[model samples]
Target: MTEALLELKDVYISYLGVEAVRGVSLRVTERDFVTVIGANGAGKSSVFNAISGLVKPAKGEIWFNGERIDRLTPPQIAGRGVIQVPEGRKIFPLLTVKENLMVGAFMQRDKKKIAENFENVYRLFPALKERPTAKGIRLSGGQQQMLAIGRAMMANPKMILLDEPSLGLSPIFCQQLSRQLKALHNEGKTLLLVEQNARMGLSLANYGYVLENGELRKEGTSAQLLNDDEVKRAYLGV
Candidate 1:
């Protein structure tokens, strides 16, 4: 088996004295697409936040590329190439698209490599290439999401943690976003995704886990999870 690029070992995360993720153990292999699906309040996004170092793990460990990262700061994590595109398309509203992307490259000083990453992002997101100077807030919701992912790309991440990327997108836009994500994975980018849209997520995921009320309830290869009676009944609406 390939060594995991990211691993969460019995990770527990809390908020305001209440545990949000309890003993969650999971892994994202290099170049693999993994998704954790759950309903709202199921602690899925908390897992991502912990891995990205936005919140400290109250217990357990998070490892990335064979190094412990649970104690790292959020910026430190991103700088190490474990970038996250948070939910809600949190782009810099006042900055132009190009500027926002540049901010994602803040930790890198090599102008040549930065330029190359920019080229790659633009190639992946042709819509972004069309309006590089548009203020982030001026873009449509789908466009804003594209910018968020493209900005993360500027960081040249070894793996990306995405939180509910389809949160408020229209169905059509969600379909398009899934296509983009699949393309990214197909091109060998590793991904760890937290999504509430179970069917959509499972459709694109190579492997999946189900989280419920702060604990893992089920896990399997995408085909297995999709065909699971519990998953189909609880999340897939089949």
Candidate 2:
């Protein structure tokens, strides 16, 4: 088995006397594309929040690349090469497309390296290159989502936490996003994706975890979960 690049052990998170995640343990192997699929309010985003250091866990541990990270600040975590593309495509609407991408490089000091990353991002999404001066608010929803992913990539992350990348996209756009995600995975980027679109998520991932009410209900190879009767009935509506 491949060594784990990211691991959570018996993690618990709470907010205002309510527990959002309860004793959840999971792992993502190096360079693996892993997906977490669950119903809304199942605490999937809460898990990502904790991973990104946006929410502190009340109990347990988070490990990345053999070091503990649960106590780190969000910027600290990003500095350690863990980045997130949050839900809702939270692009800076008032900023130009290039400026918004530049925000991702706040931690880096090497201007030349940052410029190289920007060029790579523009290469990946040529539409952004064509509209570098366009305000983010003027882009289509799909373009905004692309910008979000591109922004995260600009951080030079070792592992990216993606939350609902296909949430509001049409089928064609979702398919396009899935293809891009697969391409990233093929290039050996580790990914931990939380997605509501079970069919697409499972199809792209090598391993899959099912979360329900903040608890990890099941986990296995993607093919196993995809063929499982209970998983199909509950999540895939098969």
Candidate 3:
């Protein structure tokens, strides 16, 4: 069997002395699209932060490509191709679209590879291609989200951990974002997404884990979770 591309072993996170996450574990295999769905304060972003090495776990381990990475720094983990598109579409407000994308490739040394990544990002987000010089702050909400994803793509990541990609998008933009994400998955990109939009998250991912108050409340194939009565009532508003 193929080893998991990413795994978290009984992880725990704390803020000051307060526990934010408690013994959460999950896995993502190659080419898999996985999602974690929950309400606000469910510790979804905290988990992504731990995976990105922004915040160290107070307990447990994180493994990527069979290597223990819980002890690594943020840059070290990012160097290993685990990139995160953080919540709130944190693109640089003053940077032009192309400039913002180039920031993601700062670690790359190959000039040709950087060019190729630019091409790929533009292709994935034609709106960015059309306004390559526009300041990031000028882009609409959907476009900013696109730029955030594009920036992460510029890093040539093996896996992307996206935190709440659909948060404030209009229904139309959400639909568009969903299609773009699905296209990325089809192209063999491994993704781990966290979202409060339960229906959209579950629909897009093949496998899902539900988080409730910083704990793993449920885990199943997306189809299974979509049909689950408890999940329906609590998350899907069914």
Candidate 4:
């Protein structure tokens, strides 16, 4: 078996005195596409935050590329190429499209590599290429989402943690976003996505885990989850 590129071993997270995640252990092998699906308050984002070092875990360990990362700072984790494309399409409203992408390449010192990253991002997102100088705020919601992923790509991440990437998009845009995500996976970039839209998440992933009330409730290949009656009723609305 391939070694896990990212692993959470009995990870626990709390806010103030309350626990948000309870012993959530999982793994993402290199080049794997994994998704965590759950309802609101299911500790999905908590898991992502812990991995990104936005919040310290109260217990357990997070490892990336064979190194411990739970104790690292957010910037330190990011510097290791574990980039996150956060929810709400958090692009800089004041920055132009190209500038926003440049911000993600902050850690890279190689001009040639940075230039190549820019070229790759533009190729993947022609809409962004068409409006390189447009302010982020001027783009539509879908366009903004594209910019967010493109920006993450600029960092040349080994694994990307995407939180609710399709949250508020229109159906058409959601379909487009799904295609883009598949393309990224095909390009051999490992991904861990946290999404409330279970059907969409499962469809996009090869493997999936279900989180409920701060704990893992179920996990399987995407096909298994899709066929499981409990998951269908609880998440698929079938």
Q: Which scores greater on TM-score, model 2 or model 3?
A: 3
Report backbone clashes per prediction. 0, 0, 0, 0
TM-score of each: 0.98, 0.97, 0.99, 0.99
| Model 1 quality (TM-score) | 0.98
Candidate 1 versus truth, CA RMSD in Å, comes to 0.9
Runs in model 1 lying further than 4 Å from the true structure: none
Q: Write the per-residue lDDT of candidate 2 for residues 62-120, one digit (tens) a residue.
A: 99999999999998999999999999999999999998999988877989989999988
RMSD of 2: 1.0
* Residue range 1-238, candidate 4, lDDT tens digits: 7789999999999999799999999999999999999999899888999999999999999999999999999999999999999989899999999999999999899999999999988887889999999999999999999999999999989999999999999999999899989998998899999999998999999999999999999999999999999999999999
How many clashing residue pairs are found in candidate 2? Answer: 0
Task: Candidate 3: give the clashing pairs.
Answer: none
| lDDT (10s digit) by residue, model 1, range 1-238 | 7799999999899889899889999988999999999999999878988988888999999999999999999988887789999989799999999999998899889999999999988988898999999999999999999999999998889998899999999999999999999999998899988899999899999999899999999899999999899899999898
Please list all clashing residue pairs in model 4, or write none if there are none: none
Compared with the true structure, model 4 gives a TM-score of 0.99
lDDT of the structure predicted as candidate 4: 0.95
Error of 1 at 190 (Å): 0.4
Candidate 3 or 1, higher lDDT: 3
Colliding residue pairs in candidate 2: none
Poorest stretch of ten by lDDT in candidate 3: 1-10
